[model samples]
Target: MKRFLLLACLSGLLSLGCAAQPAATNVPEAIRVEVTGKKNGRPLLLVPGYVAPGEVWREIAAELGRRYQCHVVTLAGTGGMAPLTVAPGASYYATYARALAAYVQQHHLQKPVLVAHQTGGMMALRAATDFPELFGGLILLEALPAPFAVHNPRLTPDSLKLPAREQLLSRLVSMAQGTFLQQQQMFISTWATDTLQQRRLLGWAAQADRTTWANIVYESMTTDLRPALPRLQVPVLLLGIWVAGKAVKPDLTHAQVQPLFERQLAGAGAGGEVRLHDTAREFIMLDDPRWTLTNIEQYLAAHPSKR
Candidate 1:
């Protein structure tokens, strides 16, 4: 989820904002990749959310790395990687999606299992849709094919072009470093229950390229993949969080959530399933590592690659 419901709220609390077209610039961007574990193990590509470093998957990747070769990706424009200068009217989403496809091809991953969260999930979905055969399976962590439209069928990418989110990013980006960090701390506090993890989140947010981050948020909110879902060829698994804990009146039930997930999966010719965690928040892996890993393991086992 963009900013953990700040950008993609199934609750419809935060309306996504639009951005002004970016000017052209000359810069070559590279995604930072960290490969580890058994050289012969099945490739597990891990992608983190907006402003997060690939290390965001450190804890879970470590666990999975014991059995799989994990290629953790920190996309260009964040985590110390130089930001990609998006041309006017161009899409950051497209840039990232293409980058992902190229990475898989360049690395010869042999139908890797892809695990992506939030904006990264959006990117992976686009890439998977465009190059389905490159991946063994798709696992989206708290991501929707059309995040903003999940709660509202009426919303279009054009409709979410509001000012609040974009303005907020502007304000945050303009703030002094100390103040910006404080704002980040406040922004992400609700995303994770762990204070330590919260600090790590803050650290990444601080290191992020403010300009690229703004473009990413705008692009993510404005893009919807539902129409392209029909092109999906690989098996998919959506792991969504219902709430941090307890059943609140507003929090949706499986009966309610399942249908939406099914709708998202309906377009996938290969089909898929959803696993909602009632007790975890946006950072489900950090909140419940065991649950996240176990679910992923099960999915991988059930959908072994057919190379």
Candidate 2:
């Protein structure tokens, strides 16, 4: 009888141990934002490019957070946010922007400087144009103009048809299911210019869901921000990667891309300004966070509050 009692006690203990184990955390169903840095410092909002979650900005956020209030927002259907029930596309951009604007309003953030990358840059441009009162200035890293186009023979924009969306989604799922090394190699090949950036980006890319990844690329290729660029009312910064005399073909050169951006800025009539950085590309914050942060800090210092 004692043996039976001991066995039962052991079983109960095992069950208790099992129950104490922590369950996995569920990703949020909507947008998720993380705020860090000085509570009293000027507000600096970090906006990541399409498909990338707020994790991509960790390095920059960590550094910037020390001196400025940093708000890193992961759009709906990506990062820690829950996947969307609606088709993930350009409309998602508008939805995310509105949500972002609301977050700022709810928190009562002052006119914050928006720091954006790639497709995030496009979204920033849209937000700044549409909701000028919400922002103080704009910084675009590795920015592509509205009607963003890449002349690569290997890549073509997905068709507008619904079938194309399914095809793209399937490809993304397959890529996500690949071995870690395979996924890392794919990201490095596509975005990272050097080994260090490649390593960092690989980590960021791994955290994203396959569907979000596909949606970002599809939205980036199809959405045209050209019409809205000229309407932005804030100062702008354009940071780009400099590739000089490399045998390798770049997705787009600074010379080829800068003029397009400049033209759009001139037309926007917002009195927006553009500054070029040859040292970095689309992921400037990752490539050189210190430099990027310093530039942003200095720019904000020079531009007093318009609000």
Candidate 3:
């Protein structure tokens, strides 16, 4: 009876998972779910990072879709999509996880592989952990089970000091509430490029809801998923950037970050592997789409799923 009720609840949410597209050429450039690729191929879902649109997966999706059906998801409050309606003090990540899982069910996807970036990666991990049978595999790019834990595995959610978490949340909120120029500047510094086109793209990210962004960022930093990692039944692939050529302060070298990657893979049960790229930054898809596509194909081959 309990399982029946849960399925019923999920069925309702699936109805609102995505908006219908018109036959005419009036489809929204930015949407929740944009399907493309081979019509008779395996299903794969691409989830973009926080404050990023599904368009970020354009190049890779186009390539990967040639052999696989790609379902690109643009999270709400970013990329001109409507924000999820919620009351005060709601967990946006929880809402996103449900919406993503529903999207898979709604599309009748049979064990789709989930490829996610940053915060999307974290949400995908949560979804996979909760509903392991729904997915074939998972590929997380530069995601963290918990920021504090990645930096130091000795720290758990309970061991994390509240004052430090509060300060981090406060800073993230301030960044989210900053002006377009301020936000653009922040993006430029992190990405280390300020071309005219890049600035224009940053405009979309600048419009994200401050409250929603802050909530998810706070959750990703504070919520430790190490305990739930062992629950994952599907194959997991984690990719991290070395940033060897980039000029930055207190640069995170591969040697330093490799340990964190090892810890994550260790906690992710038996079906997981980690790969650290030499030159990619946060945006691995954009930095090296070929490498990303190749690795994904290899991983999918290793863990074949039936539809």
Candidate 4:
């Protein structure tokens, strides 16, 4: 059960990396996109992880909006947004990847920078891999190409298991709503330091569609992006948190985390840079706004949209 429990650790935790082509396909209403800031600024997309609402990026987007046109997204089924089930033979991650591609095309974004967190980062990675030309740059927060690699670097994509997601799904299906929320809040508290921020994340969890969340988590955990790292066409900046509230492995330190991230970067060729923070939790923006904002600003400066 080590694999099961460890994989679920971040279920409590926490997406991107787009190109702009033309073609207007209506993005389903389930995935809400809220665009604002700089009438003529560079297109910037911020995607949140797990069951988080678009609100998670509010502060960061507000600041980034000063120079970039910010398009904040609230994915289907979470954040009080409508939930949707993928049709047979389709997965949420793949579907969203296609939708995001359409979004960039429909909106006419020219190689927008994709900034995603956690699950959202995983989804964006899928899109980047499937459509490498969709983005000019990617900035990922508390995201890893594959969680298993952090625990066991020897675990290659070929060795990864796409476990039956039913065990975890059944647990959520049977748990009482109140109890479910309470347990989720506890896990979230460990990952997000601020009580108010914890409450906000829990608020989204409470309203989230459990089935959809489990499905996304299952698809995400089962995915292995390490193999695709070398194929990523855009420059990537990964901002990860090693300290703050890491409950899975209480003794987890920056040293252990840094090497793993560096290992992933080693596979990414010259287009990757990783910066791991020790003081901030998984919810870096909420726990350490200044640090989060500063790193993003620098990444954008280095990978300007003009490219």
Backbone Cα, N, C clashes tallied per candidate: 1, 4, 0, 10
- What TM-score would every model get versus the actual structure? 0.85, 0.75, 0.80, 0.87
Candidate 4 ranges with C-alpha deviation above 4 Å:
1-26, 156-163, 244-251
- 35-121: candidate 4 lDDT, tens digit per residue: 988988988888888778789999998888888899998888877677776664357776776777788877788988888888888
Please report the candidate that would top TM-score against the real structure.
Answer: 4
Model 3: per-residue Cα lDDT over 1-307, one tens digit each: 0111112112222123122221221123223898999997899989987777888899999998889999999988787777666445555565677677777766688889999988888888877876776888899877766655665778776775443434543554554334424534543534423364356456655666655665665566567777788878786898867563244435556777677677766877546788988866566777778899889999989888765
Question: Residue-wise lDDT of candidate 2 within 1-307, one digit each (tens)?
Answer: 0111112112222132111211222223446778898998888878887557788888888887787899887866555456654443445555556556666677788988888877677777766766766778888776554433333322234533333655756655664244534644533533545787677666555565656556555565566665566566677877665442122444545676456556655556456555555655446676667788788777778886665
Candidate 1 lDDT, 136-196, residue by residue in tens: 8899998787776775766897766455555645654576877656555554645777888
| lDDT, model 2, position 170 | 67
- C-alpha RMSD for every candidate: 5.3, 15.2, 10.3, 4.4
How far residue 182's Cα lies from its native spot in candidate 1, in Å, is: 3.5
Model 1's lDDT to the true fold? 0.74
| CA lDDT, every model vs. true structure | 0.74, 0.61, 0.68, 0.72
Off by over 4 Å in 1: 1-28, 164-172, 244-254
